[model samples]
Target: METSQITDLKRILANSLEGIEDPIERSRSDFCFYLENVVHDEGPHALTDYIQLADFHREIADTLMDDKTSFLLVEAFRGSGKSSLASVAWPAYLASLNPSLRFALISKTDDQAITQLTGIEAILRSAEHQRIFGDLVPHRQYYNFRAPWSEQEKVIVRPKFSRFPTFLAAGVESSLVVGKRFDCLVADDVIDLTSSFSPTTRNRIKHWFYQVLLPTRDQRWSKVVVIGTPWVADDLYDSIAKEMAGKSFFKHIRIPAIQTEQTDHGPIYKSAWPEVFPLTNLNRIKSEGHFAFQNQYMLERYDVTQSILKKEWLKLIQQDYIPKELTILQGIDPNAGRVTGKTGDMLALATVGIDADRQAYLLDLVYIKGDIQEQLLHITDHITRWNPKDIASEIEATQAHFKNYLEAKLKETLGLDITIRGITSKNVPKPIRLRAMFDAFIAGKVLVAAHVNWETGDLEPLPSLLPFVEEWISYSANAPHDDALDAVDIALSSVLEYGGRLAALTIPSEAIIIKDRENLEKEEEMSEEDLELADLLEKYEKNMTGTSVLANPSRFFQRRINFRGLNL
Candidate 1:
């Protein structure tokens, strides 16, 4: 942890010094150097801007310079300066250097594209900008400046001495320059909120993009660059990603707000800009607002309408306690794979215990994929280790093999006889079954036994248990992984008679503790003498060490008290 902190500090110091090192020369050469030193977009001596973003800007600059570049998709967070850096500084700098780089700036609406173009014009007019570009900078003599923001004022100053290309801004609905071809097409804010959420609007934007925008690309000069905050998982950006997956010219950079660090135990997500987005601040945002955090910062999307389980409904048991007098049950979802690989799904199994209050406390869960024999070996190991009182499995043709194999293995190797009851889990669809399980959670009938330590952002010492909560938080109808949810549903069956099977049967009398079911109600009605007698019995029980008690030496006094209670 100390090494990590020191490394972060060194990086910060290095970025702060980046501007000071040959500022004039580097500013002319590097995009990041120019932004930090000349324009001071982060304010005077901010010292600690997110320099992590600079590498991506450098990538864009390099790609623009390369001859073979075809497409670049950049998904960054809300305040990462995707527009200010790429849309403004990059184009102005490139135009100043060569002046022949024709560029078309675009957005979801005409007004937005104009806004980006205006930023470029404003930069071109800056004192430092004019000094650097000198005769090359755009001037009043080059093009007509118009009132407010419009298509007429959209193009940057035309090539003054050279027959090179210039910059133009247009909405997705607008046409590119009629007789002119754009060498580089840069798009920002391509999808608005309303259009992103509605299928009809997204489709409209898709149709408009192919019809109007694709034609603007000059296949010979530079690649198309689209930069924006991704609102939906399956938005237009996803379509491009799919089409470009196998192509050689396609490249994209997805910068998330929080970056995950892998630890020996598990992975922990820390803010990329901890100064601006500390974990405390992010935790509050995540706890109070789910969808916003996910869409804005995480660059992931979920249709909440299709969700059966709400993350906030999950309950965690405190005080590090599991109910002593409860029934233990197990549920299994076998993957029946030949190997542990990314190609196929895995096995999901869960153990649950039901208390007197009918609350189901999730005890343990296992999700893994491997060879069929290897998986059976894994399950056999779990059975020997857990020794759960009752086990449940869905009666599917695929699962029957797993069920028989598990039973057969346990008896053959471990010499333990276990029942594999046919648990019919497919009577309801997955969503419906998951919803049924979610109902139990929402009704406060389900609790997880996790240690109370949200400071480190998890229930430590219960490393195996933390993924259950994370799975709940990231669960969606179109989720890529369903092993966790399936396991949870199987565990929840311990509360219902799903498929003619009891959630859990009574524990045998020999295994039962606190056998008296009506003792609590009887306490209030019992007479003083009867209560005194019960008190003596409780004391005697407390004195026992194991099944035997060494004389308490104060037993004579206890015997006298017992005698007094008998006389009463």
Candidate 2:
């Protein structure tokens, strides 16, 4: 643990036990005190030693204990003890405070719900609890008549109270809570991975929550707590957030595992619970997979199963297989402004090449994270290397100025005036354009260079391709960043517009054939301009006879039309 964390723990401990004399009262008042002095079966380590409590845990406990806040939603990271704190410990503490208040513990299934209720049962039946407060369970003589104890429900010894059990365990789809009412309701992990992916299951869970379980709450004085990790967008948690937008009684708290802050130099990342999950441990988890880490730990919800792009659609080939007469183009998707930190939008550039067969290849990709100068230099370097036939950039209100500046920079650096073509996506939706661009992948017309081992002939992905591939496989409509996809789409659209007929195989065979002249006497009476036009037309026909129009067809047409009024 860090020195600051130790200091914060000491201060928390002092405040928790400051003016409290009786142990029972201290445990009842402060939830942190209860976890430290009463609950002893947490794990192999003590609460104050190895598994030190974080401030967010205290915040959650305080919110649960608050009387004004009736509804609380906690979207915490996985493995952050949210279940133990909100569902088990908080309900037990409430029972200790007032033994007659009925509570409901809900999960995705009945078995999982009962498992969580068992934790509270074990705490109530512990000797420490009995020594501190009293016997919460009823005696053998009064078990059958007054209070009944079972796995599904546990009734404490509350004389002259309502017939509802002290704690009731039920699943989201269970009918045990049909007519039963409760003082407190805790929904834990009600939306699992399987339910999150299915719209039917998600709707069912939502219906049960809003229709059945919510009506069971005592309207006079009741509290509801929903605690779970976010699975995907528009799930139950998102529904709750939208429903309770500006309500003062509802409190929503989201705690990510890694917190980032931008400073003067760069970004700094720190763990939310450093004692439990340090920086080193968090980095190790991040290395496993970017999508998993973001979804589970960072609480960035993404449903890749619903994404349009798939991993198996990416085709890898050797670099030597590229045709010699390939035409390359560069695409740019610049950021709105200069990027200063990791959270800022990236400047994405993609170099795509096309062959006579209408196949596309991802030659190279560049991502810049600095200011405009750095981005300009990086783009200039790419232009120098690839010598692309055209450079296409997304030109919006924010990027129009940057485009002008980029053109000037190219003229100053390379001493060559190059005009950049602007591509606007305002009329078309992004997902539709992206689908059209990636359809080449589905058709087995897109290829990437594979990193090959010379001796063993083993093929792997090139280092420059990993980031793009990761984004490709995890592409969703609600993805955080789509700059790379936008860049590639721009480049692909330019290539298709120039040589789309060749790829679609829609050109007429008669367009490429040159018929013999009917009269040679009319050719002798032609002027010099007519003679030049005829010669040029014959040469163009010869070139188009057996070759594909994949080599800058737009430029070829412009040059031919500018020389004279020739239609071929």
- Residue 361 of model 1, lDDT score: 71
lDDT (0-100) at residue 272 of candidate 1? 58
TM-score of predicted structure 1: 0.50
Work out the TM-score per prediction: 0.50, 0.54
Question: Across residues 41-157, which tens digit of lDDT does each residue of candidate 2 receive?
Answer: 367553433224689988998899889999999999988999988898778878877898999999988899999999898778877677766888887785776677889988987
lDDT of each: 0.63, 0.76
RMSD of each: 18.8, 23.0
For model 1, residues 1-568, the per-residue Cα lDDT tens digits are: 6999999999999988875756556667776666655454555544444234455556666765555657878887777677887777777887777666777888877788878887787677776677677544434642434212244343444444323247677777675545557777788888855566666678877777666677766766666888888876567787777768867888778877788989999999877567667878776665434455666778875453454345556655532345687677788877744432325566877877776655577778777766777777767777767777678876565667667777887888888888877677554445535654654554445666655342222233245655666667667656667776677676666556422232222232111212232333356675666456556544554554232112432222223332453532
- Residue pairs that clash (backbone atoms under 3 angstroms), model 2: none
> Candidate 1: what lDDT?
0.63
